[model samples]
Target: MGLFSKDIKTMDDLFVHQLRDVYYAERQILASLPKMIDKATSPTLKQGLESHRLETETHVKRLEQVFEMHGAEAKAIKCPAINGILEEADDIVGDVDDKQVLDAAIVAAAQAVEHYEIARYGTLIAWAKELGRADCAAVLEQTLREEKAADDKLSAVALGEINRKAA
Candidate 1:
């Protein structure tokens, strides 16, 4: 359903809708990571992407658990925001010729994804608590910390080496 659809008549409904949104986003990130990993020329970047791919798997599972805990169906709705971000990443990565530059592009793309996720998870956590589901918030908080860490690692990789080599 669209964000403004009458189907979300209450805060709880809104929370569930956002939950599904992030669910779809996390799955998309999971699918896209392998390609990013392969495209990365830097060993540190590649290893970080791979490691986060594993974490992304756990993120999906945790989202499912949150769904069950919140008594909502464990399903995903189309998240256009994530789709657009991933598509833009692909476009940018494909346009770059230099492998080192491509690694930098990949890091930038991955950071975009991480930033998107961080926003979604942060909002979800707040909504969960507002809905009196601190349990769900707590679960989502774990993923938020991971997402933030992933973003930080991407920044470190970019500033420390990738951007320099690309330059």
Candidate 2:
């Protein structure tokens, strides 16, 4: 439902559509991460967010390469799923007054984002392989690995200290 609708009659069109969806999601994350970093109280959380931001920038570049390889111009279709997640995160974080709790909330929000990216990349990689674009699949698998690592990092941080500190 992004800039195009009902016209995706082929797997290639579906693949390209998803690529645009993730591209939009990544850009939204790039904008949202700075705010998450600023609101984070824990040094570790802030550092993690910063590191992820850099990784996200790299993800964007990789996505661009994928688009180029596929012969499509890199474009973003509005991703309402990511938009809703980000909005919900802002609402939840804004409601918290405790710094420790806020840090935990940030981790939760970040994990949500990571999970979303992982799902998207996973599907995209499978589709790439199905379409015989091993190159695209390889690139996407790298991003999926990074997303899972980031999710695991967030979980560890939350479970090891952030949530307990909040309580």
Candidate 3:
């Protein structure tokens, strides 16, 4: 169902829809990270992406837990926003020839994904709280903090060396 589709008739429905949306996005990112890791030339960047890949696995499971906690079937709906972002990332990464520049591109792309996730998780937490599901919100909050840390790590890698080396 579309975001504004009539299928969503209440706040709970909206929350579950969004949960499925981010669930799909997280799965997509989990699949895409290996490609990004392979494309990355920097050891630090590769290791970081690899670590986040494993973390993303936990995220998917956590989302499943949230689904179970809410008594909703765990399923993923296609998230066009994440698809577009990943497509654009693939295009840009493929276009770059320089290794350093490519590493920079990867960091930028990864950060874009992270930022998208942060927004989704943050919203999910708020909605979970609104729905009186503090348990679900607390679980989502862990993912949000991890997403933010991943973003910050990307920023550090970019500023600490990647961008300068690319330049």
Candidate 4:
């Protein structure tokens, strides 16, 4: 459903729908990361991509458990924001000839994605707790923590060398 769609009947419904959105986004990230790894010129970027890919898989499994808890099918809603982000990253990376600059671009694109995820997961956790679904909140909390760590690592990569190269 589009943002601000009147079809959302309750806070619970909106929460679940957004959960599905990020669920889809995470799965897409899982698929796109390996390609990002391949495109990365820096060994550090490649390794980071690979590590996050594995983490993404675990994330998907956790989301599956959340779906079961919510008694909702673990199906994905189309998340255009994430799709656009991933597509843009691909387009930008494709156009770059400088490996260092490309790596920096990739890092920036990734941080954008991580920030989006952090926002979603943060809300999901709060909603879960507010709804008295502590189990769900805890489950989502794990993903939130990981998302934060990923963002921090990407920042370090950007500051350490990726930014240097891009300059």
Candidate 5:
């Protein structure tokens, strides 16, 4: 069911829906990251993306655990927001001819994804707590921390060298 659909009648329903949303988004990122890794001109950015891609795999498994704890099978709903972000990244990469500038663009695109994940996981943690699912909250909190770390790393790579090199 779509967001705000009749299928979502309680906070728990809302939480599950969002969880599914991010689940799908993470899967999409998994599919898209290899291309980003290949396109990246900076060693640091490529390495960071590779690491995050591995982490994303763990995240998907954790999400599956969460679903099992909640008495549901792991499933995904479409997340157009993430699709849009990934598409924008592809467009930016396609348009850029300079490797250095492309590296900067890749960093920016990655940060966009991290920011989206941060928002989703942060909210999921809060909702899990409100729903009295401390177990889920703790697990989601771990993912949230990882997302933040990933974002910070992207920022550092961007400001430390990529941006300057692009300029």
Candidate 6:
């Protein structure tokens, strides 16, 4: 139960709930990255996925810290956005046969995931600060910044060459 529910009725409860949502989302991404990496035709894109996988592990650890800081057990609320994105990626991956087109699909799917993470982390950082946990905000900000960088890196690879090849 969250702050709005009968169980938890504080800003902290709401914050932790949101935190757990992203925590679960990140773990889901981590589990999915390997499949994306294996399917990626571009060396750079594969490396990017692998790197993001590592970063996600770090992100999970940071969330654990936030949980500890809040005196709550680390847990995850279901995140439909992530589930939907991953399911879409699976569908796209299945539909493509050409390596070039598949690479494009993977990149597009990855950007979707990164963008979702960026939005969640951005919101969590602001919420953490609003809840008077600047320390937690700082940790979250680190993950947020990385998510943006990863997105930018994917865009660069796509715009620089991958999308043109696919087209």
Q: Pick by lDDT: which candidate is best?
A: 3
Model 5, 1-167: lDDT tens digits are 77879999999999999999999999999999999999998999999999999999999989999999987769999999999999999999899999999999999899999999999999999999999999999999999999999999999999999999999
TM-score-based ranking, best first?
A: 3, 1, 5, 2, 4, 6
Alpha-carbon RMSD, each predicted model: 0.5, 1.3, 0.4, 1.2, 0.6, 1.6
Q: Is candidate 1 or candidate 3 better by TM-score?
A: 3
Number of backbone-clashing residue pairs for each candidate, in the order shown: 0, 0, 0, 0, 0, 1
Report the Cα lDDT for residue 6, model 1: 88
The digit string of per-residue lDDT tens for model 2 on 2-35 reads 4357878889999999999999999999999999
Model 6 — TM-score against the truth?
0.94
Candidate 1, residues 1-167, lDDT tens digits: the string is 99999899999999999999999999999999999998888999999999999999999999999999999999999999999999999999999999999999999999999999999999999999899999999999999999999999999999999999999
Distance from true location, Cα of 109 in model 6, Å: 0.7
- On TM-score, the stronger of 5 and 6 is 5
Lowest summed lDDT over 10 consecutive residues: which window, candidate 4?
Answer: 1-10
TM-score of each candidate structure, all chains considered together? 0.99, 0.97, 0.99, 0.95, 0.98, 0.94
- Against the true structure, whose TM-score is highest? 3
Give the better candidate number (3 or 6) by lDDT. 3
On the 0 to 100 scale, the lDDT of residue 65 in model 6 is 92
Cα deviation at 124, candidate 1, in Å, is: 0.6
Which residue runs of candidate 2 sit more than 4 Å off their true CA positions?
Answer: 2-4
Off by over 4 Å in 4: none
Between prediction 2 and prediction 5, the one with superior TM-score is: 5
- Per-residue error at 136 for model 1, in Å? 0.5
Tell me the lDDT of model 2 at 53: 100
Candidate 6, position 14, lDDT = 78
Question: In model 2, where is the ten-residue run with the lowest total lDDT?
Answer: 1-10
- Per-residue error at 27 for model 4, in Å? 1.0
